[model samples]
Target: MTTDQWVIPFYQKQFKWLRDAEAEMANYLQIEANNIEEQIGIEFNSMLDIGAGIGSIARALDARGIAMTTLELVPDLVEAARRRSPKSIDIHLGDFYTYTFPKQFDVVSYFDGFGIGTDEDQLNLLKRMKSWVKDDGSLLIDIYHPNYWRTIAAGQKMKIDDAERIYSFDEEHCRMIDSWWHNEHPEEIVTQSLRCYTVDEASSMCEKAGLTITGIFPGGAMDFDNWTYKETAPLSGCLSYRIKLTKTI
Candidate 1:
C-alpha cells in the first residue's frame, strides 16, 4: 500500500486512545506549545500545525492568544479536534501532501510526525511546507534520531494494559517500526514505519528545499530500565530532535 493509504489505518489504531484523553493530555500539550515558543525565540502572531493530532497543541497555543490553524489526515482525529477545539481554531481535514492552504503564517510547527514515505517524498513535503511559511517565518519539525532508534531496535516488547507493542528497526533503511496488537487478538496487528535521519542529513535535505536550519533542540530520552523519560539529553543520546528552520534567503 502507498504511504498515505497505510498511514490512515496505522495511526487510527495507534492513536485511538487519544480520543478520550484530551483533558489528560492538556498539560503535556501545553508544555509542547511552550517548547515551540521557546524554540521560535520570538513572538508569533499566527501558527499552523501540520499533522495535528486531536488539535491539543493548537488549543494550547490558542489559549495563549496565538491564532492557530491545523491540518490533519485522519477523519476521526479531524472530527475530534473540531469537537474539542474552539470555533476560532481552523481545523482542516486533509493530507498535507495534497492540501491547499488559504494563507501563510508566522510559524508552522510539525511535531512528532515526519518522514512518512521515501526520501524524495520528504523533500517534496519540505518544499511545500516552505511555501506555507511567511518570508520571515519559521518552521519547526521533530526528526527521529537514527542512532537512538538503532540502539533500541532489538525487537523490544512492552505491554500496555491488555495490548502488546513491539518496537523494531530496519537497519538497512534506517527506519523505526512499531507494531501493536491486543493479547486476545494477537493475529491482528497494526504497524507504522518512520524514517530516521541524522542531523547532518536533515541539514542537507533542508537546504535543498530552500530552507536553512537555525537551531536544533534535542528531545527527551526514554530510560528503558526505569520506564521513565528524561526531559533533556544530548543529541547523540536523545530519541529525537526538533529543528528550527527559516527561509534560505
Candidate 2:
C-alpha cells in the first residue's frame, strides 16, 4: 500500500486535532513537562522524536526552546509537522528502526507509537532505539495496557466520524485487532493490531533490550491513572503508562 493509503489517511484525519495541539493538548503536557524535565535532570539540547505523529510532542517541546528533530513514517504527516513546526526544527521522513543518526541525541522519545508493530517488531525496535540515545539520556515510550483488553473484547464496533470499525481479540496470539473500512474507499477493509502488555512484561522486554526503567508516569497525567512496578502480578485498571528509561544500567 502507498504511504497515504490506509493507516496514514486515518491518522491524517484523526490527528487533525494535532494541528492546533498547542492550544488543544498543551495544558495537559505543560502541567507535566516540568516534572519530566526535573526527573531526567538537565534540560535537553538535542532530541529525537520517533514516530512523531504530526509532531505533537516535538512542537510542544520546541515551544519551550528545546532543539528538536522528528522522524515520522508517514510522508504526509511529516509534511504537515514540518509546516506546523518552527523553521529551526528538522523533520525526517523514514522508519525509526532502520534510520541512522549522525550523532546520538540527549533524549529519544516514541510515545504511543511504540505499540504500532508486532511483538517481535516492538522488541527489535526498542533494542535498536537504545543506540540512538546518549549514554544517560532517557527513552520515553508507552504501551496499551493488557488489563483494559480483558474487560472490552470482541465484536465491539464503533463509528469514528462516519467510518465503522470492529474490535476482535486474538486469544492465541494475545493481541487486539481493529478492522475498519478504508479511509479513501469505504467499501474496502483495513486491519490494525494493537498489542497489549502488562507493566512487568513490558519492563522485562526493556531489560532484555538493555534498558533500565527509571520511573513510570500515569496516563493522561492524572493521579488516579498510574502504573507502578510489579513483580509477577499483572497491571490492572490502568490503560497505559509513560515509561522513562535509560541506555545504561
Candidate 3:
C-alpha cells in the first residue's frame, strides 16, 4: 500500500515470499533473546521488529508470553504474517520510518535488514527508531560488515526449488544485489538490493542518532545456536551487533 522504498513494489507481487528457512531463523532469534536476557537481566516487555518478514521473530517471542508489534513493508508478506501470527501480536503494514507506533517498547530489533538505505538515510531511521524506544530500551541490529562482504565473489548464482538466484556486490555503489527468477519463467526477474555498512559507520550513525552503544558482538558471535556474545571479535567476517541504545543529553 505504501511506496516508501524502491523495492516495495517489486516484492508486492513477487514469488510467494522468501524461499528462506524461517523456522530455523526464528530459533536463532530466540537464542539471541536468551543471551540478551542473561546479560541485561531485563525481560522484554514489548518489542517492535522492523522489516518483520513473515513475523518469524514475533512468533518466537509470542511463544514465550512476550507482547510484540511487527512491522513489514511488503503487503503479501504482511498478510501471510497476519494469517499465521497469534491474536496477541500487533501487526502493522506500512513504511516503518513514517508509521507512528502506538506505544514505546522495551526493545527494538532489526534482524539482517539494517542496511537497506544509504548511511545518512540509515542514521535518520535510527533517530526515528529511537523515538519509539523507552528510556532504557535496547536496540539489537545485525549489520553487513564491509570486510566480510568484500570476500564474497560477485556474480554468484544458485538454484532454490524452481527459482534461480544470482547474487552480486557493487563495490562502487556499496550495495549488494540478490536477483531471482524462475527457471520456467526467466522473463520475470526480480532484484533486491542493500547498502552495506561497517561497525565504525554504524557507530557514527548511532552517535548522530543520539543513541549509545553498550555492546558490540562482531562476527559469528551472533549465531545464537553456535556462539554466545562476548564483546570481542576480530574482523574475521560477517559481524552483528546486539547493541544497547540509550538516549543522550
* Among all candidates shown, the one with the greatest TM-score: 1
Better of 1 and 2 by TM-score: 1
**Range of the 10 consecutive residues with the lowest summed lDDT in candidate 3:** 221-230
In what order do the candidates fall by TM-score, top score first?
1, 3, 2
> What would the per-residue lDDT of candidate 1 be over residues 1-249, giving only the tens digit for each residue?
145556898778766632365678777888887888999999889999999988888898999999999999888889888888899899999878888887999998888979899999999999999999999999999999988888854467888765688888898998988888867789989888889999999999999999999999999888787888899989998889999999998
lDDT of 2 by residue, 158-189 (tens): 66554667777766666667677744566766
Q: Which ranges of candidate 2 are over 4 A from the true structure?
A: 1-23, 32-42, 153-156, 182-186, 220-235
Regions more than 4 Å wrong, model 3: 1-5, 9-29, 32-41, 219-235, 239-242
lDDT of 2 at 112: 70
lDDT of each: 0.87, 0.70, 0.72
- Per-residue lDDT tens digits of candidate 3, residues 1-249? 233355675565353634656665666778865765654557777888888877877887777777889888888889889988889999999886689976898888777767776766788789889988888887777776665455543565667676787767778977777787878888988787777777677678889899877777664533333434444566555444445567775
**Model 2 poorest ten-residue lDDT run:** 222-231
lDDT of 1 at 30: 81
TM-score of each: 0.95, 0.79, 0.83
